[model samples]
Target: MPRDPLSRLQWLVFALVSAVFTTVYIPQPVLPVLRQTFGVGEGTASLTVSAVVLGIALANLPFGALADRMAIRPILLTGGLVVAAAGVVSALAPTLPLLVGARFVQGLFVPALTTCLAAYLAKVMPAERLNVVMGSYVSATVVGGLSGRLLGGFVFPPGHWRWAFLVAAALLLAATLAAYVGLPVEDHEKARQAEGVRFRDVLFRHDLFRIYCVSAGGFFVFSSVFNYMPFYLHGAPFHWSTRAVTLLYLSYIVGVVAGPLAGRLSNRIGNGAAMVVGSLVFGAGLAVTLIPQGWAMALALALVCAGFFTIHASAAGALNRKLSTGRGRANAFYTLFYYLGGTAGITLSGHAYHLAGWHGVVALAAGVLLVPLSTGLVEMRLAQRDGSATRSSVARAR
Candidate 1:
């Protein structure tokens, strides 16, 4: 591909990714409003978010497999259409259950847009460029996530949240059409062959499993805090309005910078060291959120977004670095674990919030953060041992 067109294509990928995340998170900032609109409890209202995550987790494998077997053009076209249609249905639905169901349908096809697209990038891009491009990919997600929150909570007037869905659906539709026209079609025969690679083949690899755990663990803590934050601010000494709460999501901009920077850091120091640093930042930020002051909360969230995306970008770069083939399946499993963690976090944290409020959610999240922290420690040990072995072999050869 020509450099100019490739640049355009990269932009298209970013826009499509941004659209997907925007649709996925559109309901998040408005959870409190949804709870009242639907006349349901916080736990039930949360289903709007978790249900989509569950759908993504369930469908990722098949989409990942398809990514290896099929060209991505049709996949993007179909997935975008279905998700957009579902968004429209969600907007039009008369009841909360229908809205949740539509979101679930949207989730089922999301892998086609996300995991499959990621695999496509891995296949098409040069190995040396993967980490940087993937970092840009993660930054796109930050834009999309922040856009969704603002659209849902701030752009549309109160009680008109359905318009957010409608606008998101339209944006998805536009991005889908643009990607369909803009993305290059790959020849499957020319793409790296997966051969007999099985889903379990990637899932069971120790190194890859640890990377997957990072995905799950990092998102678990991040999702738990953001998913339930509306309720936390609404009832507390803060009593922040919907728009005020939405503004806090601006902290997400830190992730746009963090993603690419973490990618570079991983390149310099290795993924294990990067992960260790990220986990420390994450844990500290989570601890800081305990302060009741509004400025403290904003500062805490910036740290949280920075830390989470740092772990996330490094993990993504690390996973791709370990892969020579079957990247579609591997990336799929990464996303499957990622959203599953989000789903689990939201579900479990809902109970925590109901029982003991934000503190309970924090307590649960603190326990979960141990997964990434421990995984990072183990990764650092393995990297050190491997480096020592390499040096010894080189010394003997000399």
Candidate 2:
């Protein structure tokens, strides 16, 4: 709505991103309902969500590499259509296996909408604006994620879960069309310029590896907490209705704020320090979830979203800042780690919830939190060393 001519284009990007994420998450809030309707165990019902994540993780690298080599328009059009088709199949799927498989197909092409687009933006946007824009990009994801949960659980209700998939497909198709028409065409010159930064180079670099680990660990905790939440609340002391549980996702709004705020905080204090503070806030949120009251849990979830997105935005900004080329591959690696962590988190948390309820799940996630916390510390030390070296060089020149 601002006077920036770029604002309209940014909204289109936000819309497409939101649609893809909405498709990815439409099955989440109804996980308990899925278990009943499909006659499956908790673990199997979760496959609806994790299957998509696994697909995304497996396909990210190829999509990432492709983004660098080709224009995103063709990739976006093809991937969007395929994902939308798969989503329709999911709505009509008779059996659970077919449904999960269809969801996996949707997952496979999601990176085209998300990762490739991120790489494209990095390639095209001005350097000074990249941080703020990427932060807004993360905020768009918050909108999409929240929309999916509400549509799955609230608008359609758990009984009509399949309709949620259909609605999501329609939305995605519309957004994809808008994106295809609205986004600027990538010229051959830019495509050729994108070359360099081999796969191994991105995979092996210590700096990038640490950032990847931060992404993995952060999502590992985030996914574990959210994916299993319905089961936890449905049973035991808090037998909330599906609608009540779905409303809890409104807490995700905090992430919309956190993304931009984190970007500014990172710019002011440095990414390393911002990461450390975010990690601490996230760990505290996880701990607070142990309280039994509804208000307590709600507040805790806000903290969780804010903290997680802060770390997420900071890590993304840092990664892009480091890349001069091969951004698609680099961001792809980031998504690969991000979703793989989510997949593992869902799987492991299933076992944990089976053994000791929500407590066990939280315990396992808290342990994984160490990865990001330690990574932040190492980053802080590295940043300090680099700054000292720079100062010394400046002194010598003077």
Each candidate structure's TM-score, on Cα atoms with residue i matched to residue i, is: 0.94, 0.94
Question: For candidate 1, what is the TM-score?
Answer: 0.94
- Model 2: weakest 10-residue lDDT segment is 188-197
lDDT of 1 by residue, 1-398 (tens): 33786577778888899999999999899999998898999999999999999999999988877777777778889999999999999999999989999999999999889988887887777777766666557778889999999999999965899999999999999998998887777777855355587888998999899889889988989999999888989986989999999999999999878877997898899888888889888888888888999988898999898889888878888898889876667777888899999999999999999999999999999898888878878877988999999999999999
Question: RMSDs, each prediction?
Answer: 2.1, 2.0
TM-score of 2: 0.94
Clashing pairs in 2: none
- The 0-to-1 C-alpha lDDT of every candidate, in the order given, reads 0.88, 0.88
